[model samples]
Target: MAISIQIDRVSREYGPVKALDDVTLDIRAGEFFTLLGSSGCGKSSLLKLIGGFDRQTSGRVAFDGKDVGNLPANRRPVNTVFQSLALFPHMSVAQNVGYGLRLRGLSGSTLETRISGALDLVELSGFGQRDVNLLSGGQRQRVALARALVMEPGILLLDEPLTGLDERLRQQMRDEFGRLHKRTGATFILVTHNQDEALSLSDRMAVMHRGRIEQVDAPARFFEAPANAFVARFVGIDTLLRPERIVATGNHAEATIAGQTLPVRVEGPADLAASVVAIRPDRLFLAPQGMPPALTLMVVGTTFRGLHRDLKLAFSDGQTLVIAIEADADIGQLSAGQQVSVGLKPDAAVLISSAGLPPA
Candidate 1:
């Protein structure tokens, strides 16, 4: 059965350093969740607390409302697939997959059946007898996944399992993870520093920084309406303009920037000084020849990006914003210091706080 997790005011201290600082989070049963952040962000520390490999110094770690902080790793209904994979290279793939079952006294046809089933689940149906040492990187990754799934734990923890794989294999394994999550209705908690991995695999994800959660929400929410400026930058919304003046009107606003006014979207009452305009690159375009332009800025630079070209435009005050245009689009005449008209789609410019907000 899948298990729900409750981490209430969890704090993990190592001497003077606090790896996890009063963190509180709830994960639903059978949902795919990701803990995302850069290194040393307490994501791995929190995972250790959940897996029972390490206990919290203060606060409670619960599974389905029952405290499990005192339980050892083996006693908890959890299994982890670490980045190292830790496969027994001397053993055959089948032996590695069935090692846990054998330790629990499972043998004969029963053990073989479980091993075969696990291998089949990871699409490694007939390679059981092959030596694990000779397998390719991706195949070895599958073997590790098979070993973890074979345990049938209620909660599966993936700790950077795709860390060392090449880009193509990483993508392949990422899709495999999504497929496995659906095949087995276990609560999946993934810890990854890679944003692409977290954004693609998680049903919902938490962004952690400096031993605290910055924000928690679905992937699209992060792109559409980030919690604050830090999250806006993290999710690829790089253009944040501090408007010289702003006029409020319900959920919409008009912000004056570079001597021109542009329509901006807002969630609630916005403080003119505290809020900044977040411009999404996808929402920017070249001004229509017959229509009035929102703002006319000087082109500072351009970079070729295969399918698209990134144009860097600078305001009068030297503030720069990058917008992508089609590679084949006619803009060869545009050069540095040349003035070009740009248009912003309605509600494309979001008014967000310049400061970081508390995690939700």
Candidate 2:
């Protein structure tokens, strides 16, 4: 059975420091939802609150509209697969997978059958007899997942479950986990700092900054249409351009960069006092033809990335912009300190609001 979860104004504090501040979110039934943020941003705290591992100071957490904030961790219908894997060193894979059920006093052939079934669900059917220490990192992770899955909890909280794995293993586990989610129909809430992992694995993601959620959206929309400066920056737009240069009428805006004014769409106005037009590296291009008379810049440097070349340019007025162009393009003709015209097509950039509130 699929279960839905609601987090209501959940706040957690450590002495005077607030880990989570008035946080509220609704996780859909059986959806793979991710809480994404940098460390100390309360992503883990929020996960802990949902797991019943931590209690909210002022708010409530509920399952399908029933309050669960006061319930103990064990009493909640949830299970967590921590980052450490936390498998007992001496135990075999089957022992670990059956630990929770065993704790509930289940044993013998029934336990054996359930453990075997859970192993199969994670695609590790025959590995139950293997020592956990003998399994590969990815296998151990699956074992941890199996342990959580076998419990048959309504919700599964995964805390950076792939943090230590190499890139290849991480990606493999990511795909496998998605498959597991589909097969089980259990709500999976994963927490991680890896943007790629969150974007790739989550059906929907919440981008958190400080102690609050900046925005929550499906992967495609979140990548293409960020809600704010923090989301834009954190979600992978690293370059910046002056916002005033962008003149907004409504859904559309024209930005003046170098000597050129290019049109773009503004999702909405932001609270930032300063705005910088943003673009992902892949959105930018290099053209042999000089930029329109309206745009001009001096090439500063270029770096070769296997798939593309990264170009750094500086406007005569001392502003800098970075653009990535095709690797085999005629970027070689451009050198340091050479003046060049730059242009941005309407679909190539986004306007991001800078920090609107002044530093206290």
Candidate 3:
């Protein structure tokens, strides 16, 4: 019974400050969607509106095309797992999981069966009698999830649920979420400031900034075809070059930078005055000795990063870009202050508009 959500022209205002401004989005049923951004970006505000914890000053919030703006949190078929787990320390694992069900008139064998199923779903089947206070951090997280899932909510909202867990536990819980989503077939809406969490967990994600959605698409689209300069940097495309000249024809373009012309892949006719060339690290490599180099730049510095080494290459005009190579690759006298020939793969460089965009 997954529900599709439609947020039509939503705006949440707090006195004078607007938390969400004219935001509109549609989330498909059973889809794992994430709202990603830094703090004060209004992701949480929108979540509140959806969860019925807060109401919008303007616009509509609908579930399955039915407007539910007037519905209270308890009346709506939604469950939220907040950052602070808020599990009752006085209750046992079974008691905590069955609390909501019991309040809705479930009791005895039915309550027990529901509790057991929820615990089993979270992989905590045998720990029902254990005191919640005695559970480890990861176990506690599972308990919180089980509590939410026990009600069989159509929409599960995760509000930074993995915020304070250790790295190993975070990864473990992240996988668990994906598995549970499939098992329950609920529409999962996650709000996270961590890009890694959003990118890894979401089928599609929206990047929010300053109370607005900057871009919304599948995870790969954010990397392959970012809507603007802000999104390009957010998804880790760091080398944005202001090409001195660009010759465009269809999806292919030639961008001249530092007196070297390099092939660029473009989606459409690029605005030459407003666009910059984006160089993805995976598409850059050391030029072969026999082939013509795309650009010869000096190795300004190098840093060791375990599996690979990052070489900071600088052009004659002081523009710099970082490229990574395998740690054990042959360097043949490559060091700081030495010139190195670098080349770009076909369609590696992308022409993106640079208009009032922030640096990563």
RMSD of each: 2.6, 2.5, 1.9
Model 1 misplacement above 4 A: 267-269, 356-360
> TM-score order of candidates, best first?
3, 1, 2
TM-score of 2: 0.91
Best by TM-score: 3
Worst 10 residues of 2 by lDDT: 351-360
- Give the count of colliding residue pairs in each prediction: 0, 7, 0
Clashing residue pairs in candidate 3 are: none
Predict model 2's lDDT versus the native.
0.82
lDDT of each: 0.89, 0.82, 0.88
lDDT of candidate 1 over 184-220, digit per residue (tens): 9999999999999999999999988878887889888
lDDT of 3 by residue, 242-304 (tens): 777898888788888888788887843487667877788777899989888888999887778
Model 3 misplaced stretches (Cα beyond 4 Å) = 267-269, 355-360
Better of 2 and 3 by TM-score: 3
User: By lDDT, is 2 or 3 better?
Assistant: 3
